[model samples]
Target: MSEYRSLEDKLNYQFNDEQLLGLALTHRSFSNVNNERLEFLGDSILNYVISLAIFQRFDSASEGELSRMRSSLVRKETLAEIGRELDIGELIKFGIGERKSGGINRSSILADAVESIFGGILVDGGFLNASSVITRVFNKRLEKLSSDDFMKDPKSLLQEKLQDMGEPPPDYIIISTKGKSPHEVFEVACISRVLKKEARAEGASKRKAEQKAARIALTEMDRDR
Candidate 1:
């Protein structure tokens, strides 16, 4: 519990029931009384909160556009990135086997833990508190989001940008693979000869790795302009 003080500080929200927080961090691999139920509840709350936020924020957006924006915000990759930002990986309790297999950094586990924490907050404080926390955590992301950005995926956007500039489309190549079947991690590189830029990222699947790499390359290109 003492060790979680840093995490609490990062969240800017303290738990009245430390046990709820503990349960939120416990993976099924660690205990039968794990965070799955909380994750389920949190998933619902997250969707609702983000939906309402975007609805009010993007008053001009169509329903389909709002849905796409919400999906982008609540996706597993985004949640896992949030978990990493909050340092939730260190707090997750996994079974010996899972720990040995590097479960802490696994995106699925990190994303689940984040949702469970939201669920824990809801149980401890109530909907208002959970909404507050969710909004606070997602505020920056929401602020930076644009209707045009959510309309296209990173790959599509990158390709379109290159095409508009008369440059060739970027190429995605799998650079490396680790682990075994069903749990393999792939490293992919997004390369663009015209821009002389390359970005690499790792993910649970080749597609995800390619998307991440493309996102990174896009960011770098944006920075250069």
Candidate 2:
């Protein structure tokens, strides 16, 4: 019924409840009409699934520890990775202007689509089916992120660094977010804790944006040493 038909075939999964898939493919910008509800359900479902996964995966983890891990899992950047894997980016529907700007590949959009897909599957198939599919999609990410390298995403790492320095911590300012909800322009800056200076970069999410800024700041800080 739509371009997403190709994507459905690609993911090696089909929905008897085709409407759910349709809802997932629809973008909020296309109209206020469809996607918002799915996104909402998807968001909650994702949180529940991820929390369960974290709780079981790390039994010794503290509440705060589990929370940080959950945040790492559910962030826009993480969901975008799942969306990209399904090639959902190419199949998404967008408004005309948003389409022209390449919104489909955006981290935020891809992330939202991941939620929509989760919500859709839950509606059509139930939590078990939705969770199975989502788990399949997230398995590799889960494994990789569990590694030491993912100890902190760029944002958290920067915050920790600032906190260690006894500073107020860096805050993000979005300079530009173009394209569509998915593949848009996202130029972000990190405001200094003390100097009030700012460093900036373009990335798909706030984490990425902040990472770039932090990298710059770290380099500058080292230089002064």
User: Candidate 2: minimum summed lDDT over ten consecutive residues — where?
Assistant: 145-154
Candidate 2 per-residue lDDT over residues 1-225, each given as its tens digit: 655676666555678878778778788778776667888999988888877887888777655456657776887888898788778877677888888888987889898988988888888888888788767766776766553432445567666757867887777889888788778758888787553467778888766777777766654543332
- Measured with C-alpha atoms, the lDDT of residue 181 in candidate 2 is 72
Q: Which lDDT tens digits does candidate 1 get at residues 1-225?
A: 377898888788899998899999999999999999999999989999999999999998765557667877888889999999999998899999999999999999999999999999999999999999999999999999899866567788789878977999998888899999899999998999755557999999998998888777766664454
Question: TM-scores of all models?
Answer: 0.68, 0.64
TM-score of 1: 0.68
Q: Candidate 2 — which residues are off by over 4 angstroms?
A: 1-6, 9-12, 147-158, 161-225
List candidate 1 segments past 4 Å from native: 151-225
Q: In candidate 1, where is summed lDDT lowest over 10 consecutive residues? A: 216-225
Top of the candidates by lDDT: 1
